[model samples]
Target: MIKTIIFDFGDVFINLDKHATEKELLKLGLPSITEDLEYINESYETGKITTIDFINYYQKLLPDVSEKKIIDAWNSILKDFPKHRLKFIQKLSENKTYLLILLSNTNELHIDWIKENVPFYNNFKSCFNFFYLSHEINLRKPNHDIFRFVLDNHQLNPVETLFIDDTFVNTNTAQELGINIWNNDPKKEDITNLFTIKSNLF
Candidate 1:
């Protein structure tokens, strides 16, 4: 039986324009995403670099873009958190039917934006038994080690844990580690229908 649920934040909870950042950067005269840019992003996501360094790296690349512009473009991906989803999770938390954990590959800048914009961020956070932010935890997903860290730290059995993520890559890694998964398509699926949609698994 699935006794625990691990949820990814972006697209799964807060909506995201997956292509917004790339498009914004391109508009800012970023030629294309380079290997170095990807490395810098991954490093920032994993808390290997500071927010100041992250912004500076981009500023150095797009010399004409101001720090505020760089930050705005980077955060353009984040969208609104729907009220129904918050209610669903809050109800789920109240019932205590399963151990609810939130695991997100997020950085400081995005989080700061959410704190300022999402009025219920704190309420949403309070629903989770454990909240794991990649930058805070020094780990990011699609990496097997991060999944293992969650399991080990929570003393959770992989077989009894269900991982839900909008990204197939992330769910795939957890599946290989023996966790049940739902590779949710944000366009077609809403997490509020979790039990109805993944009824067989539950």
Candidate 2:
């Protein structure tokens, strides 16, 4: 019996063009997505660095690119939050059937953009018993520690928890810890169909 539900914010709830940032960066003369760049991104997501530092790092890498352009390129991955998904989660919350939690590997700028764009962000947040932003928590997913932290903090049994994420790596890590997972494919699957799609788990 899944008593708790953990959801990934990107793709799983709010839509995201996962490759948009890389594409935008390339247009801005990023050269290529190097290992160093990936490290910086992971650090930023885990709150290891400040927003200013993140922008500065990019600025140094691409001196000709303006700060505004860099910021825009970075946020290009975000997309609209569909109303139907919001309604489904809201209805699910109203039922109060499970301990709902949201865990997302997000940074400051992206969240600021979401706050400005997503009108029902507050209402959506209220639906979850716990809401954790990776930067705020200093923990990002696909990391065993983050999953373990959530399980330990809430006294949740991994066997009784279901984690839904669009990333295979994240779901794989969670599954290794004995947590049930739904590796949702954002392209082909809609989160609103969660019950019908993963009805066997319930």
- Candidate 2 overall lDDT versus native: 0.95
Candidate 2, 1-202: lDDT as tens digits: 8999999999988999999999999999989999999999999999999999999999998999999999999999999899999999999999999999999999999999999999999999999999999999999989999999999999999999999998899999999999999999998999889889989889
Candidate 1 — number of clashing residue pairs?
0
Error of 2 at 134 (Å): 0.7
TM-score of each: 0.98, 0.98
RMSD of 2: 0.8
**What C-alpha lDDT, on a 0 to 100 scale, does residue 129 get in candidate 2?**
99
* Candidate 1 to truth, TM: 0.98
Which residue ranges in model 2 land beyond 4 Å of their true spot?
Answer: none
